[model samples]
Each structure stands twice: as structure tokens, then as C-alpha cells.
Target: MRFQRSAVLCLLALLAIPAAAISQTMDYDRLDARLTRLAADEDMVGLSVAVIEDGRIAFAKGYGVTEIGGEPVTDDTVFRWASLSKGVAATEIAILASQARLNITDTVGSFKTSLRLPGGGEQRATLEDVLSHRLGILPNAYDTRLEDGWDPAKIRESLKSLKPVCAIGECHTYQNVAYDSIAEVVEDVTESKYADAVQRSVFVPLGMATASIGRSGLQNSPSWARPYSKRGRTAGRPKEKIVNDNYYRIPAAGGVNGSIRDLALYARAHMGLVPDVLGETALDLLQTPRIYTRREQARMSSRYRGTVRDARYGLGWRIYKYGEAGNRVVGHRGAVEGYRSFILFDPDRDTGVVILWNSSSRQPNGIGFEVMDMAYGLPFHDWMELDTSQAAAGH
Candidate 1:
């Protein structure tokens, strides 16, 4: 009958709705169950997560207690982004480049940084090289000095004294001090403090309400999660930790602080959702693969080791091929003492996961892929390693 034919057409149309639109309505019972189990786990002190689909937040929630028995974690509970802050710097640079305010190809020596590479490598090295970890210096150069309370500026000044591991632009040698030196260039060009420029350009325009830079930003939050660890005499029980300002001193490489909501918004903008905040050109510039990261690929979880391949470093991001389809996925993970954060998203699909936890557990690392599996219509896998007691093992 005509009525039956019309009903069939209507049903087909409804089923044909773009996945992004229906993603908002997708049942999250599986995710909720996993998060609930994680929150109650022995090693997980406090955690918050946000899932994004098509540039919209599909789900945002917090789990566990802020400080062992302290306040419950909420989406608004601020947590340190740790090295995840590097992405902010990369994003800002991309925006600046789009506006013709600065050139990433400029030599590092031309800036105000004290990054004197051996054999005049700084002269040969470009700002893009610095952001992409192509400094050819020792990995995490001067990180130990920074943690030991040495003056950050002095630490940067000492980078020139280190030996080169490879020629500049030949290999990916990560650096926190040398990396943070980009802040000086940003300050010079923006005619404002690095943090102020980031605030005005990225955070404010993207509406990252609780996002901020520095130690004060984390401590000053109305509700912030305290870092925790199972070290010392804790008998494997996570204990509250003091918030160290050492890494915060290198605000560009680290020191970003924000809530789950703020991070989700940040990810959404990076997905090219907020055109007013960021455009495709800026996103492309920030995410283009610049250097292969073989060590990074080796560090992947056993579950992902097979599917995630050809790892590479971008401006401040990590790019890898995922799934049987070899889909390009952009992601980054960060850790600082007792806190761990992971962000993974498919820019093409505009879907990703952001996780923040205030403990030394890497259990949540798998959750990002679990969400992505659902997005990709792949079968479920125990990427979270929930069955194993080794979930508390270091990332």
C-alpha cells in the first residue's frame, strides 16, 4: 500500500542520518560501565573524561574522589594537562602563521631563545624544527634540571652545553626546555606575555572556561584534583601528592591546567569545528607529520601495537595509522609525576576522546581506542586491559 511505502522511506531516511548527528544519541552504557569500574579501581584516585563526535561533546563526566577521600571529581574539577600544553603552543603558532604574524621556518637563533645547538645547529634549525622535536638534542633536555628547581632560564641557557644526538632536523629529539623556548618567540611577536597571547588567541576564543597556564592556575581553581601516587610506604595504595611547580616553569611545553569540559572544547576546536577559533589551514599546519617517532610507536599498548603504526611527531601532536584500514589518527599523551592525560581523535571523523586522571595509573589509555572503535564500527576489544592486574603499571 502507499502508506507502507511511505513508512519504509521514512525509516530509510532516519537510518541514513549522518553518524555524527546520531552520535549524540548513541547509548553510552558501555562507556559508562567501563568508567564506573575504573573509578572504583584501587589505583585510580580521581578521573575525568570527555568524548567528542562531530565537534560536539557527546559525553562528559568525572569519576572517583579528588584526593582519596576528598571531594568527588566532576567535569569542572581542574587537572594539570602536563605536557599536553605543548599542543596549545602548536595551535597558537599555527594561528599566528595563518595570520602572517610569524613564520615557523624562521631560525631559532634569530629569536630570543638561548638554544645554541652544537655546530651552530640553532642557526640551521627552524622554529618548526623545535615544535616538531627535531632539535637533534638529547631527549627531554634539561628536564632533570628543571625538576631539581634550577632556574628555567638557566636550564635553557645550559642546553647549548649538551652534546647533539643527531644533526638538527635529522632526528626527533624531544626537549622541554628547548621546546618552551618558543614562548620567547611568541612573546616577542605577539607583544604580550606567552600566556596572555595564548589566552587571547586560543582559550578565550574557544571558550575554555577553566583553562589556564602556570602553577597558580592549577592551585587557584575552585575545584582541582590533587595528584596521587602509589610510591613509598603506601603499600600499593595511592597517596595524595604535592603539586610541583617545576614543570609549570616551562609553560609552553607543560603547565596547562583545565577541566574535562575545557579540554573537550579544546579538542573540538582542534577538530576544525570552531571555524571562528581555528581554520583548516591552521589545523593542517599544526598536525602535518614532520618527523618519524619510532620510540613513540614502540611505547604503545600491546593491544594497539599492531594496529597503530607509522608513528610520527607533528608540531605538538602525534600522528599514527590505526585500525585495519590504516586510518590516520592524531593524538598525544602526557604525564607529570602523579597525573596522566591522553587525547586521541580522528580529525577526518571529528571524533575523539580526552581523559584526565590524578594518579599514576595508565589503565585509561585504552579507553580512547575503545571509544574510537565504536566510532569506527569495529568490534569491541579489551583495550583498557581491565582484566589484567597490571593496569596500574606505568605508561
Candidate 2:
């Protein structure tokens, strides 16, 4: 009896070791499969995802239908990175600033004399304030009109009519006004348009052969996925909403389009792999937190949970805690009319992930959620694990 008990105990111990080891290794495939299940949801159209591990793209894949009833999104699909453009534009501005070509803290009145703003009739804000959401203009999740639609012109127009909710550096309010001013600043200083700057400063250097801030017409250009809206809606926009489909006019704010791989390449650029479009010092300056936004706490908690410690907003990127001692993790997400996008990297680890979905409404930002989770291999108890445990129970 004693011998039999010992044999059984040894066998159990042996099994326990492997189970413990298995537990340590997260099931990313199952997590991805669970993400795949999201396709069965109501509005998701298509998605492309790339995971960068240790400074290089380790895996890139796409799923779901690119069009409502068309082919599944392949790795080649391009998506509009709405607010994500803020990061790129901010980076561009920062690069220019570092070269003494631009300054975030400079007054907008000096950039364009024709441009009139509302705050104090002559209130000035910095490039950092605008892109980092610290201008304190509004949209502290309060105003409805400022939340959506095409209003770059109106935002620019309102400058002379609006008042600074707080002092120049008092608080952070993520809005379009500062970014628009930055776009104008880019053109004013560079003597070149934002698109022209991107063409010369970034796109060309990265060899982004097909990327552009072209209008909605180009959203469907070669090597791109067709733009889409939430289900039961349009692809581009209500014909009335489009003012100048060419967002480059305000590209410094939110006008960019490119492929998942290309965007990943852009993220890679931030990690110092590609030639310095903005140079190493310029990129370094961008990672520095200009604003510590408690406003983003709730949203970051909801999306990233424990992964995002208190974060600071860089010129355009969201800086999060990366290492055990709160090392900074920098990345950005873009949301256009129909497409949604996210690109982030851990500069210390030289690792990042970029995911772009052709349709923004249906799939939502879950792609960014899952990719970030998987990138760090954060142990999570999501539905996927529940389903896996259940299946194991059955066996």
C-alpha cells in the first residue's frame, strides 16, 4: 500500500511541474483565436496586426473581411490612423523643433497672420500643449460638438473666438486647435506644407512607397484597404462632411494613411532602427512626457488595465510604464472616420506592436487591446482562457 501511494504521488508531482510550466507560457494563439471570434460580432470588417519583439517585427497577420462582403483583410491592407496622426505630426514637429526649425511653445499668431484665434484674442499655446492634449481648450470629455466630425476649419476659425480654459501650461485638454496650429506652424516655418514635410522628412526616408496624407479618395488608393464606417453606414463620409478630403492641409493634426507593415516600419523608426528622419535626439525629446494627464487614467484603466501605470503625454505619444521600475512605454492610437489604428513600442526593450483595421466602427479598438496584452505577454484571465479551461474540463 505504501509503495503504491508513493508511485501515485510521484506521478502527480511529475504532472504538476508541466502544468506549472504551461501556466507560465501564455497562450497567445488562443488569445488571437479569441480575437478572431470578435469577427462574429456585429460591425467588425477586417483587421491587420503585427507584433514587434526585441526591435523587429516578429509576426504580422490579418483577419476578417476587408469589405462588407469581400475578401478577408490581408497583411497588405491600409487604414486611416485618425488621432494616431497626432503622433506622427507631433514627431515631425518635434524633429523640426529640435533642429531649431520649429518650437512647440512659440505663439501661433506669429505662424500665420491670417489665422485668428479666440482665447484672450491673442492667447498663445505651445506645440507640446496642443499635441499632448494639455492646451486646456475643452473636450475634457465634456463637449459633444468637439468630440466628432470635420471641424478643423471651424477649430482654426474659433481660435480668435475661444478663451483659454486655463493658463498656457495649467492643464491638458486633447483637442484639434493646437494640432491645427502646429500644421500651420509646420508650413509656416518649413515653408512647406505638412504633406510636403512628411514627403521630404519621413515618408521618403522610411521608403514608405505608398503612404500619404491624401484625401479620402486616396484612402482606397493602391496597396490600401477601402475606407469603411460602422455597419449600416457609409465607407468614406457623409458626402456633406468631407471638407477637403486632403487632410495634409491639417496633416499636422490628424491626416495620415498607410499599411499595417508600413506603420510598423514607422514604429520601428521610433525605436532607432531606420535612419534618423528626425535624428536620435529629436526622437528622444518626443518620448519625454510633457503632460501627466489624470484624465486618461480611466480610459487607460479600461483598455490596458494594470499595464498602464500613470502615464505622461509626450509630444504625440502616450508614455506608459514599461519596466519593473516604471520605465516609459511610448505609443499612439489613431481613429479616423471608419478605420482604427494603434502603434506603440517599448524603447528600452526595443519592442512594439502595430495593428490597423480597415473598418473602425465594427471591430472597435479591441485589436489594440489584444496586441498590447500579447506583446508583453501579460497574464490575463479573459474569455479565451475560460473557454480553454472549459474545453480541457470536457477532455
Candidate 3:
């Protein structure tokens, strides 16, 4: 029975690799034409993309205008990073852990005593639990509370009122408040605010000069993309608007704003191209898959269909295993009110892609997949056909 079970598992894994031809070299002209056409077909307001190769940016470009007939989007046009802040937060925590400032095993109650697991159980969730979305809290637990203007301290106190869907480390659920709790941990351990610590440890070290946290960061920036949303079914263009709320309440979870250029630098550091900025052990810990996520599995199963063998959640990334080669892809995507962004990389190849856009109607994941296909030499697919079909049907 044991041998049969093992064989079954192996066969299931083999079924996950898609049959496709591999290219010998990246076709830049084809890639550029596809992206430009995709942007137009999707009615994207403004899009900026950067490709990192061998620890440096190989290609960086922008498309469309920042506003209607206004300034053109550039590689430096800042966009709200949204949930991608979780990746930055995870890196910062890993740095602190490496420096012996904080231990991942420390319980949450140690820093914020008010937060107690339901039923008063002594097995409090640890920092690693929160970072990896294994805190057992229901997905997006107390996110509305934070959005409704409740302070983090009050939200922390309110955690006791909520119940976990499973025991700590038993399952995976995406979170914002639980992830943001690390900011407090950072402040307590380093005697500095989370934003300050992240800037000093990550942004400064990586030379991500334009990267900043929260509302003040966006406000201070002179060249930033304004938020936009689709107006109507056939609006043809997205309308510019302001996201008035301050994400500082949960800055560590979803408050970052930066450009594709800066994001490329961050991705370079993750690829082990910049050893002096980020240590190998730290990056490994951050990228190591901790808890398997059903949400990720379902998403990848639908996205890749026959291809993805497994999908799991790391500290702040979604890990996808694809192709016969079982190439490991680590990446994160983010969405705010009127913006969407995606950053993905193949660490083994030390190549990655960053996509930032101001409009919310169309996500950049398809573009990320295309870039991944190029980086890995996989045969390209018409990723935009489904979206185009949907739009046509709606019309």
C-alpha cells in the first residue's frame, strides 16, 4: 500500500507538466508587440514594466498616459504597491531575525499582550505564523475594522473577539491585519517605526530610492500615478480618482508605493544578485514554502490547468511549480482601490519581471505569465484572448 501510494503521488506530479516547445532565445520584438497590443486591448490607463537579467535591469518601458492626455507614464511613475508590501515586510523581518534582533518563534502575545487566542488557549500564534498566513484567522480578518479607521492597537485588542478557522499552523489564509502586526514587532524590537526600519534595512540597502511607505510617501512624491477605475461597461478609458484613505493603519500589509525601476532593484536583491544587500540565508527563509494554501492551489490549477504540479505560500510569496523541469517561480501580486501590480521572478535563472499599472480593470498577472514564459523559454500563449472575449461579450 505504501509503494502504491508513492507511485500514485509521483504519477500525479508527472501529469502536471504541460507539453510545449522551448525557445532558444528571447524574442524581444515579439514580446514588445504583444505587450503593446495587450495594453491597448485592455484599455489600460498607464502601464510600466521592467525586466531584470543577471542582477541588472535589461529592459524598462512605459505605456499610455498617467492621466487622460496628460503626462506620459515612465519607468519612474510611482504606483500604489497594495498587498505587495507584505513581501517587503517579510524581508524586513527576515533581516531582523538574521541580525539576532528578533526570533521568528516569539509569540505575538509577547509584544502585544492584549491579543489572545480565543478560548484563552496558551498556544499563542508566533511571528512566523502571522507572516506565513498560518495564524488560523478567517481570511481578511478584521480588515474592515482597519479600513473603517480603527487604530492598530484597538484592532489588536479586538482580535480576541475573532475565532480561528483552524489551529495555528494548521492551514493557510491570506491576511492583512495579521501580517501588519509585524510592524509593531519591528517597532518594539528595533525602537523605530516599521516604515523607518523598512526604509533603512530594505529600500536604502537595495538603492530603491523612490520606494516609500503609506500616504505620506505618495503625497511627498512629485511624480506619481493617480488612481483610476473603469467608468462604465464600455467607458473605453478609466477615470482618474484619488484613494483618500491612509494605509498607515496597516502599512506593513498594503501601503507601499514605488516605480518599476525601484521594484526591479528589490527583485534583483531577491535573485541573489546583490549579496551585500541581502544575505542568502535570509532570502532562503523568506522564499521557503511554509504552509500549503488551497486558494493558491485552486488559482494555479485554473491558471495553468494541466501544468502546475503544486502551489504553496511562503513568507510573503506564492510558489508555483511548472513544466517538466519543475521550474520554481516565486512572486506576489497586489491590488488597491484603483491600481494593480505584479512582480514575479525565476530565482534559479536570476531573471524577473515587474508590472505596475494605474487602472484596476485589468490585472497584470497575464503579463507576468508572459514574461515568465519568456524567461523560462516556454512556448507563449495568447493570455489576453479570454479577457478580450469577456469584454466583447459584455459589449
How far residue 46's Cα lies from its native spot in candidate 3, in Å, is 0.7
Off by over 4 Å in 3: 1-24, 120-123, 231-234, 386-388, 391-395
- Between which residue pairs do clashes occur in model 3? none
Q: Which residue segments of model 2 deviate by more than 4 Å?
A: 1-32, 113-123, 140-154, 231-249, 322-327, 361-364, 374-377, 383-395
What are the TM-scores, per candidate, against the unseen true structure? 0.92, 0.78, 0.88
- Give per-residue lDDT, candidate 2, residue 7: 29
Number of the top lDDT candidate: 1
lDDT by residue (tens digit), candidate 3, 51-124? 76534466777877676677888878888888889999888888988898778888876884345556553257
Candidate 1 positional error at 211, Å: 0.4
lDDT of 2 by residue, 23-46 (tens): 333344664676677655444567
The lDDT values for all models are 0.83, 0.62, 0.74
* Candidate 3 overall lDDT versus native: 0.74
lDDT of 2 at 376: 64
lDDT of 1 by residue, 1-395 (tens): 11122323323321223444546444477788988998888888899988877555768889998887699999899999988999999988889999998889999888777667777788899989999999888898878888899988888777777888888899998788889888888988888999999999999987788999998889889999988986752756787788888888889999799998889888877777666678777888888999898788787735475768889999999999888898989989889988999999988877788999998887788889889888788888788877665564533
Arranged by lDDT, best first: 1, 3, 2
Q: What are the runs in model 1 whose C-alpha is more than 4 Å off?
A: 1-21, 24-27, 233-235, 301-303, 392-395
